[model samples]
Target: MKALLKRGFNLLDSLFSRAFTPAWNPLYQLGALSFFYFWIVAVTGVYLFIFFETSISGAYSSIEQITHGQWYIGGVMRSFHRYASAAMGICVTLHVLREFAMDRYSGPRWFSWVSGIPLLWLLFASAIGGYWLVWDQQAQYIAILTAEWFDALPIMVDPMASLFLNESTLSDRFFSLLVFLHIGIPLALLLGMFIHIKRVTAPRSNPARGLAAGTLLAMLAVSLWRPALSQAPANLDMAVTEVGLDWVFLNPYPLINSWGPGNTWVLLVGLSTVLCLLPWMPSRRPKRTPVAVVDPDNCNGCGWCLADCPYEAVSMKEHDFKKGHKQSVVDPDLCVSCGICAGACPSSSPFRHVDELTTGISIPELHIKELLARTEASLAKLSTDQPRIMLYGCDHGSVVPDIQSSTVAAISMPCAALVPPAFVDYVLRQDLAEGVLISGCCEGDCFHRLGNTWVDQRFSMERMPVLRTRVPRERVRLRWLGAQGTRALQREVVEFQRELAEAPALIDLEDVSSG
Candidate 1:
């Protein structure tokens, strides 16, 4: 099931990449886009609230005035509020599905995945409350159905449905309660949103400027074309047999009608429980996955590991061995075992003369020494003298083994970021391979969030342990082709090999001295 979903997402990603480009792709920025839509909803909702009436009798009339009398500004704001809320729901749903499809909602990521579940419930509650405030026939239907749903709960002492039994029963106080809830629930949702990204190192709370502007313009165009207008005023005497429904929030009403309120609640609760437990379900991660371990001897309390850790697993603490200085401490429970810290550590440099190649921080199972040995062994197997290429790929991205050949050697790491910049320089300076091609998860789609981004920054000399300026830039290539990029990886490696063959040979200082 997961494999199928992953393939579907890849197809959509490819199609959307052509239209919006990878940087502005809506699918890649779903979480950020959801946040952007939320802001739009909040701003437009505030405008609508300023002119709103908190009385059952006046609510319908005020909405009518806003819809027709002030059609230019107030009307547009109402439509923006409605559509942006729907857009937020869509983006949030897609973000959850995409994360699940990519198998990112497990292990150390479980906290983020679990925290997001409550936000869904809060969002629906807020939207439903907003609809009730309109005081139209649809809102009347929603109010009665929701009251009945609440009445089904065992904790309800007095039935909520009794309040909406007759025209005389409703009061301004009841309407005011709806208004308060509409405002209060969304504020709670906002807090949940913050908690959802608490563990992420650098959360993307906003989408790209171009994407944001485009989304807002599209919403504006929609508001201008089809303005949101309320139905006839709610009538207690008349039965609300038929009314329009916003499927994003009111889709559950149909289930309530088909299945009793008890059954509906059972279904919703069951679904939420399943979603919360998904991270603990049988997953691809090994039972005893190795976490990063800090080497106090090599660690100079640099704090690079702490900065590079995506899960906030690495922290700076007073060194037990070296007084005054600090050392990185890994919280075993929080570590995702990505090994990005290994790449960021300056001590990971291959140039360091040591019997055992160790870094400030590294995964116990796949340490720096193991990676260097793998790279050397892979490169040695390449018999061809025609511009040999060493391809480094991550476990989650392109299948590096598929493209391995006589001329090309491939080594897979937990993440592409696990390959230090010094390793790239080492490969070239030692003549292990003529060219090095680093490929991993697609741009903005790294399994370990910032793996590819950090790799790019390190290669560009914008981050620590920079790739040497002396190494020819042409010999090093970075390709982010995602999981199904085996063929693309082959093409890139071939092109890189051709480029290396056409370029001038690297000078050998040892040969010059001998000559």
Candidate 2:
């Protein structure tokens, strides 16, 4: 368990995002919220499109009727459709920009950024369809321009001109097709969203739900007040300009129109192609484990080591250390070399970091440096009160944000191993102190070679209280932390404070006779 505690929280700065916001993951949140908004836009879009007239003549009347005539479902649905589309576009744009700010796009997340391009295009395409359903002059232009662009593509045999010539593909049919496309394209985008996030586990959700609820309430309220009205019917002949131009969706249309189809084609396809190729981008995954070699002679056969190893790399197969108990054997292939097995060894045999024993390949990384700096800071903030609480945090166990520094007096150490036996004694010697909390990585995945394991034995198993027996007996605790164990660290802090609060005044240990 000590091994699990070593993972530290990363500090991030951007908009409303935090590296580790609550126990609720922020990664899963963004993914889900993006999806939720996509669904929202889709649902509202369907409801609105059902009542919409696609013909340049009737589209304006149909939208006006839906917004003003149908006060309940159609009215609300029309505004919702527009709002949801706008919200999704805004949120996704902000979300991606936030990721960019956080530098999440550069590393393993390159795929996410790459896949996001298609999603953006699909969203805009869907947005454009929403505008086209209004069947206003703006929508007419969009429909014609979009068709012309498709016609320009060599893949299609003059699709725009062919659609205009085909008697079956009238404006009414245009509306139907746009409805079909708006729904279908977003459906495809949803699949892409999943693909973008397939590599990640347990994504974040902080702003997603909150954003959804806020969006729903806000849009609903707005629709109730001043609902949307479709503009005068589209007139390709008159060249009429004024209409309900959904800038969020149709903003690109103006640019595309001005730039000509060729430039837009180059920009869109070029950008999309770049986004799709992100996975090939180089990155790194830190080795989660190191290798371990066990000496058969000192094995206790208690299976504690086996139980302690987080990856299940260590198992007691055959030779029993204690009488008939099976001796532990470690699976080299599965082991990440976390050194939790070394901590669990009951015989108290000293073990080196797996790197030291094998090739000594394990080297300190950036996180380690961060931990040491933070540890020195934590140590300086230690306090001695009526029942002072001693907090021993492994560098990797907790994420200490700058804003949260006031409450926690943190002390960082290389490993739980560096926690000398006397330190606990020294802390306990201080009047008004309760016990000590030694938080390390999860017991099995200790980064150091059995450092926490060694600490566990010398304090708990070997040491005893002089007379009260209770003083040294249970005064020390061992907690295992994972890489993302911010909540655990916080809980430990509050619980330790509470325990100290409940304890009686510190006693003078010198009076107790050694038993």
Candidate 3:
């Protein structure tokens, strides 16, 4: 059944994901957009119904008047209302099915799984309520059928039949109650939707506007043509007659009319159970995690890789360089391993490994390419006699428009901690670049939470003893730059640039020859 569901929705899933660039699961956004468009329908429904008449005789006339006399705007409003509602129902159904297919409703999310059953029920009820407003022939049949089912509940006497149907109990108050219910039922729908995803944080919409807007317009066009209007004021006297039907709201409404409400109720309830429980069922296989690995030798230790890790798993440790800086490390336990790190690798040290681990590994080839790129760019802008700003930025940091500049050539890295001692010695030898400023994410903000922490760890007292051979430790410094750290980045860059100008050059010739 799970496989079948996946097969059925495979096309929709692809379209929705491609519809808009997705950050994670496509269904995640699909469910979000479902919520968004539902609100759009409800809001439009309220506006359209604000002037709607409740009396059976007046209801038909008022809707006709809305369509005919006020055809221009009312036409559009009615179209919007129908389209939005249908789209709402469609997206919501898709959402429930998608969740089930993806198997996200199990474990901690079981409650949300079960709560979704109410949406179908509420939507169906709302559709019935929609028919009731048109006061058409179908609306009359719907009312009669539903009222009969209500009578079966054994709650109260059949007042509508005993009074209105028999020309005895008719009153303005009865119409008012139906009107109130139509207005109130949507409140239940709103509550149901809210309850459905209560556990999800942010509960964002995935619609990219085009698909969402197109769906609304399309539904509206269909509704206006068939516009859910009722049969002529339901004659209590008439027994049975040919009548128009709208299956969109409750495609099975006519069946309920023929087969009796009791059986229909059972069938609907059974289907609802199946729909709601789907997300509840556990998946046969565990979901795969997708993050790559970084090679220290090929990795320039730019820390770009650290900023992109959304799950906070990658960190920098001492890399290939002698006794000076650290390399980026991956905590297998925390890595969701989204290959955003691999995308940012300067030396391309990190990548999806085709071997045993499947994590990307940096080797000599990758490092040489990046090394040449960095070397060429630096030499091109080498400040001759004057002190030049030595800007070291993480890969993720460089993408930030503020950080990318001529003065700052990003040291694209798997993690900031990977900056080796030997690299520092080589940079100081260049004479043009004054002071080194390393920028990456703040301590806890590192997508790989401890990656930045590792940067701090390697730069701390533990690694200082080894730094004596590489370069004057004072020439190189580190600072954390969070994704949101625009101001801090600016401040650090300026401060580092000033420090480089004022500071003496590391005139050592030791590391230059070796390089």
Highest-lDDT candidate: 1
Q: 1-515, model 1: which lDDT tens digit per residue?
A: 87898899999987887798878889989999989988988998889888899998889999889988999999999999999999999999989989998988888899999999999999999999999999999999999999999999999999998888878889999888998999899999999999999989999898989999999899889999999999988998788988999999899998887899999999999999999998887765546578999888989998877877888999999997898989899999988888999999999988998977888899986899999999999898888668999999999999999999999999888899999999999999998899999999988888999999899989999988689888789889999998878788899988888888888776753356458
Residue by residue across 443-483, what tens digits does model 3's lDDT show?
Answer: 33343334454445444534321233455566677766444
Give the winner by TM-score.
Answer: 1
C-alpha lDDT (0 to 100) for residue 393 of candidate 3: 50
> Arrange candidates by TM-score, highest first: which order?
1, 2, 3
Candidate 3 TM-score over all chains jointly: 0.53
What are the TM-scores, per candidate, against the unseen true structure? 0.97, 0.58, 0.53
lDDT of 2 by residue, 477-496 (tens): 66665345568666766676
Tell me which of candidates 1 and 2 scores higher on lDDT. Answer: 1
Off by over 4 Å in 1: 282-286, 508-515
lDDT of 3 at 361: 35
Candidate 1 Cα deviation (angstroms), residue 512? 13
